[model samples]
Target chain A: MKILVSIKRVVDYQIRPRPAQDGLDVELTNVKMSINPFDENAVEGAVRLKEAGVASEVVVVAVGTAANQDVLRHALAMGADRAILIETPAVVQPLTAAKYLQAIVQREAPDLVLTGKQAIDDDAAETAQMLAGLLNWPQAMFASSIQLADGRATVVREIDGGQETLSLQLPAVISVDLRLNEPRFIKLPALMMAKKKPIETLPAADFSVSAPVLTVLQIAEPPARKPGKILNNVAELVAALRAEKVLP
Target chain B: MSVLVIAELDSHGIKAATRSAICAASQLGEDVHLLVTGNDVAGIALEATKIAGVSKVLHADALAYAHGLAENLAPLLVQLAVNYSALVAAATSFGKNVLPRAAALLDVAMVSEVIQIINATTFVRPMYAGNINATVVAPAGLRILTIRPTVFEAVAATGGAAALETLTATAESGQTTWLSRDLVQLDRPELATARVVISGGRSLGSAEGFKSTLTPLADVLGAAIGATRAAVDAGMAPNDSQVGQTGTVVAPELYMAFGVSGAAQHVGGIKDSKVIVAVNIDADAPIFQVADYGLVADLFTVIPELEAALKAE
Candidate 1:
């Protein structure tokens, strides 16, 4: 069985992204970038599945510019056998992303696909579900636990107020949650070995998908939080809250 | 243009988040209908009708919806979506899972996790992990929205008597079948809806320390407990207890972070919290920048004394 994992390059969560000077996009020039935290989890999930003998090969896919190859290499170092990058410098929305993913899914025909619940950058949390819809495959989101048996995968999803477990047939899409697995650091040797892995780059324009549906009117910083006063003691903290009527 | 609000429910009735979604839907269009799907959601359907501004409730009673699986929900919503100009739900987990699938099938763009409704075809949503606020405008097609309920007050559940309608459309739950559930049922309020939250960080030292130190303060304040990603990564706290960019996003009336030197990711989650209180031994923790109240003290000693002081009150 082949497992396809999708990864994205996002600003490191530790580094705050500043809005670009145009006020229509986030400044990405020279920003610290890393594999999206959840996508890192996706790579780990796929690697573990391959390790447990559930998967014969793991292919990591990214749907962005050539720069995305950087993230795909990280996925390779994490144990994916091969990588594919859809070289599109254009802004890729979820729908556009799903189309590119669908193209890759058709080509790979993997038994299962793993991706982050949401890309921390867009926070759209929509690509995997859209891909599932396009492929007409079963989808499980926010999966905390996944077990494979008898050509089916059972996933425990972190839902509102609780977790729900379900078993779905093969060729399904599952989005990884935060607690799925802790990704291991890539050893220097593994990073060097990843240089030999095959990485196929496809032009994003090759896929005939619908154009982006949403138009960006403006991008600005979210309202700034007000600066606060430091309380003298615990009593002062309680008293200040009481004075503000936030506490009774 | 009519709107359909997807209703999420518990054993008691419709959830507060769904109620807030209904309110957001009411603002989007005039005829707002609610669809309640579950194995035995007749009572919940009735509850949905009484929610203010709901003109009607569509009940899809079946075993398939017992767990809110997207496999069943997406097709079901697509079938009923023809009459509605827009589809909406809270940006909660259920909405995040189901709506995109339906939107994809319909070949429409989904306006995700919006904080404000600009118009029928426009909205403002946070992007870049709450760092940038972007105003998005979509075409005149069916607008799919997942609203953050905390940004909008939930509509009252009483003072309405809308009619309830049952749908005869069949739905396939796909190959996915409900197996089991692991729920965090606590005596205290859920962190998502909690009015007050007391969170700890890596300085809590260990899981045992996280529990023992925070439980008393949580109990005394009648607040839900939370943790920083640092603590979660350290195995000092559970994943669900984590509040950060990767974990659950929360905005409560009062938020108190103990020993939490806030990282941008953790602070990203709690930015919407009305009043933030930061307590740390370090005089210049990053958390103090966003804190409405900063306290420099040893949490180990101060928390216990604070609990006693509140108890004395």
Candidate 2:
């Protein structure tokens, strides 16, 4: 089976995010960038499938600027057999990204495609399922675990309450959940080998996808949290809750 | 203009969050129709019809829709999209999974986890894990959106005239088939859906500590158990049990934090709660900022006493 893993370079989750001075976008001047944490899980899942001999080859695809090559390299170091970069200067919306990816899927024809449940930056969490719909393929979103046997893929999805297991035919799309696996680190030797690997770069315009339908009007900071009142004791707190009619 | 709201149902009728989404939908327009897609969901459809603003209930009951897979539901929704001016659903796992696909197929913009509908054209949604709120405008047409149910109150069913519509579409599209479902049966209330929640942080120490100290208190109060990212990362609770920016966002009537030093990421999850109470050893924990009531005491000592008090109540 050929596996395709989609990755994105996003603002680091640890740092506080601020809107750009233009007030239309996020300030990315000096912000630390890394593979989206959820995407790392997707790559790790693909790597595991390859290691288990379930996949014949694993390809990592990223859609962004030249800076995203570093992210593709990281995926290569982690165990992807090849890398493809769909270069675009501006950040693409989830729908546009899904369209671009669907075009790539048509060309690559991978039996399985894995992507993060959502990118940390946009938090849209729509790409994988949208791509599946665009391709007219079956999809299992937020998959915590996956197993392949007898030409079918069994996916364990993380739902609101617990888990639900589903089986899909080959050539299905899946989005990885946080509990899928602990992503492996890139060792020095693998990093050096990754530098020697081949990377094919393509432009987003090459794909016949339309512009994004939604437009971001403005970005602003969320409402500030109210200052907390300090109580002397648990009795005081409980009394206050009762007074507020929350504890009745 | 008619607005279409998808009511998500489990084995137990319509979900509370779906009711909240319907309430949000009512805010959008006067003519609101609800679509309940599942097997043997006629009772759920009937219950949904009783909500004050719902004008009709559309049922798409079939074995194929039992799991409500995106591939199956998206097409069904796309077919229905042409009839309505706006489409809305709860921003749950099901909505997040399917709505975007439906939107893409209709070639329309979709706003996810919307906190407020500024109008028919604009919406407010959290970005960067609630650190930023982006007010977006969709290019005018049939607008699709997923409402964060926690942001709105579920409007009570106040007897409304409802018409039932049965939709049938033959499509062999969903590549996935449900094999089995393993629901974690908990005697405790569901954290996200609960009216009251008691959450613990890393200061509680271990999973054993939480199970022994906090769980009993929560059980007594008839509240759901929640955990901060610190506690979840420490493996003190399952990922599903976590409540934070990265985890489930819950808004309850009463929220109690035990030993939780509120990080911005963690606070975002509970900001919508009607009343928040924080208990910590440190008087200056950030949790106090958003908390309506605060207590300065070691949770180890206070929790047991609180449990006893609730038991006495």
| Two-chain DockQ for each candidate model | 0.78, 0.69
i-RMS for every candidate (Å) is: 1.4, 1.7
Candidate 2: deviation at residue A43, Å? 0.5
Clashes of each: 0, 2
Error of 2 at B26 (Å): 2.2
Q: Which 10 consecutive positions of candidate 2 chain B have the poorest summed lDDT? A: B167-176
- lDDT of candidate model 1 versus the reference: 0.88
lDDT (10s digit) by residue, model 1, range B120-188: 888999877677788999888688899999888898898888889998646675678878877887889
TM-scores of all predicted structures? 0.97, 0.95
**Candidate 1 deviant stretches above 4 angstroms:** none
Q: Residue B11 of model 2: what lDDT?
A: 86
Candidate 1 per-residue lDDT over residues A11-124, each given as its tens digit: 887788888898878898999988999989989999998999988999999988788878999999999999999989865899888988998999889999999999988899
Error of 1 at B237 (Å): 1.6
- Per-residue C-alpha lDDT of model 2 across residues A165-230, encoded as one tens digit per residue: 989988899998888998997899999999998899998778777845677888888777566678
